[model samples]
Target: MQSNDGPAIDETSSSSSSSSSSSSSSFSSFSSSSVTVTITKLTTNKRKSMLTVNGYEFHFKDYNKAKTIKFLRCASRNCGILLHKSFSDEFVRFSGKMTDHSHLPNTAALGIRTLREKLRQRAEHERLPLQEIAEQEVRAGLLTGHNLLHNRRKLMPPLPQSCDFNIPDEYRKDYLNRDRLLLHDSYDPQFQLHESVYKRPEGRTLVWSSDVQLKLLFDSEKLYMDGTFCTAPPNFNQVYIIQVIHHETFKLYLFH
Candidate 1:
């Protein structure tokens, strides 16, 4: 059964050569127009699906499940440009008028959005460290200094408002599907230090160590413990580190 909502595709008789030629011509025209639109699917910083038609960007606004259609609106604040797209198992077609953007196409913004998405995906899936992922992105793409902080905030998790805030699962591990790096977490709201001014625990203690570090610590005979206040992160006062001196290798290895 043919669906009434979609455009009817004509079937040509094999015996009629003229009908086949006309159908072929119509298909060629449709294919050429589809090439002109140059639709690129991309992800926004907020991880939303977006589409770029020609040079203008549009955000997914709504979907009509009954008709298998998706509606999109211009990314601009007040732009009236709208688009409709139909999808099926075989093909995707865009309806309504395209190239009717209210403002000049921002190719720079589109490029940045693409780069950010690439970085986000690499951070999640790639075994490389975040610094390496960012360095690779900078070498591959052109980035501007003006939006550095904005992009950083998008990639990093929000700072906890208080010590009682829960940490996300991703932060507890070194990478996706990798072994946990957070070795110890001692958070006590009622725990207090001996200092007279400090009545309650303002921040908790945390220790991070990797598998290799643990192996080195286990193999070493002598261990050294040191504490530093200068390099401590915000919300924490000091960083206590443990270093091991391996007997066989005769090398110093810092674990945490």
Candidate 2:
């Protein structure tokens, strides 16, 4: 949990943000000064907030509630007009639309956003894994199918870009940081990285090696390897092999 700016996303939580193709809605009429937009929590990245105003979904993409500076957009793919807003002393106000958008606001994408937010919240607060969450969302009629959901712990796309996928911003969240091992070894830099990607088995292997493990590998006469197929990365069903050796004194060593 990090709170200087906002809480960090759960390390295991994959970004499930995507656009909807079949839904549509339009902003009827909004007066920048007359209406106060309420920013509500969503399953979106911590920086963003989602609101449904008169059937249209408005996504506040880059918001600093403390500083009163924010950027907004309609969630619809066809009409994603970026908007601006600022607040001070409890007063909320939005500027006229900034980027190009539909003459009518599309609500289908907002519905998708809302659904995604709900799915993300389920993954977070309910303490459920991505498989459960993805299945539940589809069971609830949110998604059809996405291979990314099956491997939540690895190979996640970067968080949705509020600006654009090609152009990244400071606000964009980077999703893959799976090495809990790094945190424990950060204070000491003795760990050496030996990573190899395999094609035949269709997976990758990573090893954090130290000098003491090398001496064990060289000193032992009989070497052994223990492989398990029940657990692995990216695919989760591949085989992972660990090198092992028995020392002269009958001590066992493992390098994986």
Which regions of candidate 2 are displaced past 4 Å?
1-33, 36-84, 87-101, 127-132, 141-256
lDDT of 1 at 209: 74
The C-alpha lDDT values of all candidates are: 0.58, 0.43
Q: Candidate 1's error at 207, in angstroms?
A: 68
* Candidate 2: worst-modelled 10 consecutive residues by lDDT: 178-187
Q: Model 2, 24-97: lDDT tens per residue?
A: 22223433444543443333344333444444455545655444455555666566454444442122333333
TM-score, candidate 1, is 0.38
Off by over 4 Å in 1: 1-35, 88-99, 142-256
TM-score of each: 0.38, 0.28
Best by lDDT: 1
What value does the lDDT take at residue 9 in candidate 1? 30
